[model samples]
Target: MNKKRGQQSVVFSIPPILKATAAIAGPMEGEGLLAGYYDQVMEDDLAGYDNWEKCESYMMEQAVTTAVKKSGHFMMDIDFLLAGDLLNQLIATNFAMRSLGRPYLGLYGACSTMAESLMIGAMLLDGGFGNKVVATVSSHHNTAERQYRYPTELGVQRPLVAQWTVTAAGAVVMENGTDGPKVTAATIGKIIDAGIKDPNTMGPAMAPAAVDTIWQHIQDIGREPAYYDMIYTGDLGKVGKELVIRLFREKGIDISRNYEDCGCMIYREDQDIHSGASGCASSAAVLCAYLYPQLAAGKLKKILFVGTGSLHSQTSYQQKESIPCIAHAIAVEV
Candidate 1:
């Protein structure tokens, strides 16, 4: 049967089930709003590792292992692993996968990797390619700062528009099952550049892409804003969240009631994170720790998870090129 839904979406004939999920976060995130939902919280960002990158890899490994355990499966039973991170060439994920020893596919969707991995994993299961798959992503504040901006030692003064990169990792075990929330459908997004050149203004740079994907998902799925219990945009902090609302309002649609950004949900207002959180783990941690439980508990019947990404590198920034962004949306239902 053809599963293609619309121009950019596909309906899974056999929706893949999310068997279990895990979220591991650093100390600062442990003090955040969703701390109670996380599976594990480290005392510090390093977690006794020698470097922040190694710490990030450790978090991803821990998250994936915990999720697999929660799903009542062994590492050897996992048919495939799909993961990514913010570091160059996905080194964090590579190192983590080296320890996992499973067949793997590395993805690089910037901050949108979590949703991208989930979408692909669901496709694998529905296509009869894998019975069990683990989808995960990780990001570290120290690692992101040194690679994308200035070193943390430099103590660069961040603008109000800048967001804090989250130090966290999240993983979910997906399988063909009758239990748990199902991956119902997904919409693939296209790259959109709003001519925003400042890397620090990532929220603004990615907002247009988030808007585009959300609009397309709604259009292709024939669902209105009120259809889902919540619509979440990944890592589009306060600035981008408001931009999405404004842009939608201009089109005679109102999404403020059920719409929220995963970035805004991570840190407390008084945490002094400026615009809020930004990183691959921003949405990954939230989805695994919070939304999955909500769906499993029947508190939320359905949700649209839209992962937003800013596709800019240090090289592109140095060349003074505009920031290109994308977003992928997955519909999850209990």
Candidate 2:
């Protein structure tokens, strides 16, 4: 009955099932490799909104509604809604929640929000706090760029290490059911700073945090690297993925063959996405649209999803502080 596993990890006594999920991507993402997997792909980033932030909110709303519809549930059936985004004060999520009209909890984990929301939603269900919950997150390329870096109109020449903030939203409805992938366990990560100051290079900044939580999850759950069909890191891109493999190899574990980064999975080489994708939507879109189907079809039996976040703000960057990163892991099984 005791679900506590080890430090910062827990196994749910009553694992929450992901009943259904929905994903929506912008034009750029719609043109990417996983376009076929998404439920809806907008013709443009604005989707008729006047501004990019409103568009982000609209994306979140669509994702949430589509997910609820797919679950064959009414809005009133949802007990709680958990969501987040990269915008300041979680503007996108706040506006979306307004339309959702559900009891909501706003989260902020940077790009790692999807996994964070999932872990918290699982805890709510298993702890008898709720019977059903929806976990969601969103990010907009233009909004993120203007807020975190430079204005898109400036035509800033990005470095090869920089990642594109995905213009998309993803949502999953989790409930007490046996119909889909189950949330079995979770490992919460701590803030890890390796003194990486460049915001453009978030992959490397977040790799250490990903490795730390992954190692902790293995230790806590007594699972080997081969236990899962694949291990996914959210938005770590190519650089961070390699760093993770090397880090695990040093600990006598080989994860290279079984690991993939959602960042690397979303974009194609010809898309000019620089390093890869980095946003709350990066992992959320991939997981909901792609991985969920694979799990439901029994193509993937077990998997570890680690959401990686570079916890840096424009103020911090301007202050010349190092980027602090975190990663949260969730174990899912069919």
Candidate 3:
């Protein structure tokens, strides 16, 4: 028997959007969406991410701590750390774990890092490499903006569907045991190219990968559409989510009833709320605060959480190159 351990459960968490940003940008359509997300997780009253490095660090720390606390475990109990962030040199994630004081194994899959970490941690512990593990993926809208988009000084109007990289972070603790929520299945996403180039537009950048992974998950598992309770995607936002619905129907797989997009689930764009979504924190927050609770409460039975990312280069965009995307799914059966 491969008696290493089976995934007993996984817990995810995140901070709320800032109050001032929500107050200001909330009324002004989608402007407050970024600020509000940052506000929820940050300590200082940051005007923007120009000097927001410390803010990002703080968010990661909170995410890690929150995940640990909620999982009925301690930092030392975690055998290893699986973490990543879309920060320069991955400082946000690295610094966040410093306080954790546990052994670490870093990973990066852009926005898909959370699911990547969780899925892999489940594999490792289930395979006997470790007994208990922690996995996390974080992104800050501020840091993301500085790296991918023009500086704050540019003050350009990004596309509405161009999700604001959520200025947030999320973490999960997975233990090899039994009698709790378990990872029943997973489907890794392949980097798919749909030929999108603009950093300000991520819907097209991430939709193809979302489509590919969702399809793969159904195909590999050989399950019917009604097998799961809810099907969730990370940050395909409104446009991409709609496109995914259409694509699935075209393929004779109809999952509209319980299908949900994390990006679109939390906020609304029609009222100009939450300004699409473009951060690791985007899905993390939804999964942590909203989705996890609902799942644990028995309101939801089976969930397929797909994390999607746009692996585009600013340099490549400047040169008129297309953007590529990737997605991965983590299925938790309660």
Candidates in order have lDDT scores of 0.96, 0.95, 0.67
lDDT of 2 by residue, 8-123 (tens): 89999889999999999998898899979999999998999899999999999999999999999999999999999998999999999998899999999999999999999999
Per-prediction TM-score to the true structure, in the order listed: 0.99, 0.99, 0.84
Q: Which ten residues in a row have the lowest lDDT in candidate 1?
A: 149-158
Q: Which stretches of candidate 2 lie over 4 Å from their true place?
A: none
Q: Rank the candidates by lDDT, best first.
A: 1, 2, 3
Model 1 lDDT, full chain set: 0.96
Q: Cα RMSD for candidate 3?
A: 6.5
Clashes of each: 0, 0, 14
lDDT of 2: 0.95
- The 10-residue segment of model 3 with minimum total lDDT is 15-24
How would you encode candidate 3's per-residue C-alpha lDDT over 74-188 as one tens digit per residue? 7777788888888767888888778778888888788888778877787777666776777776676556778877786786766666676665666666776554567766677
Off by over 4 Å in 1: none
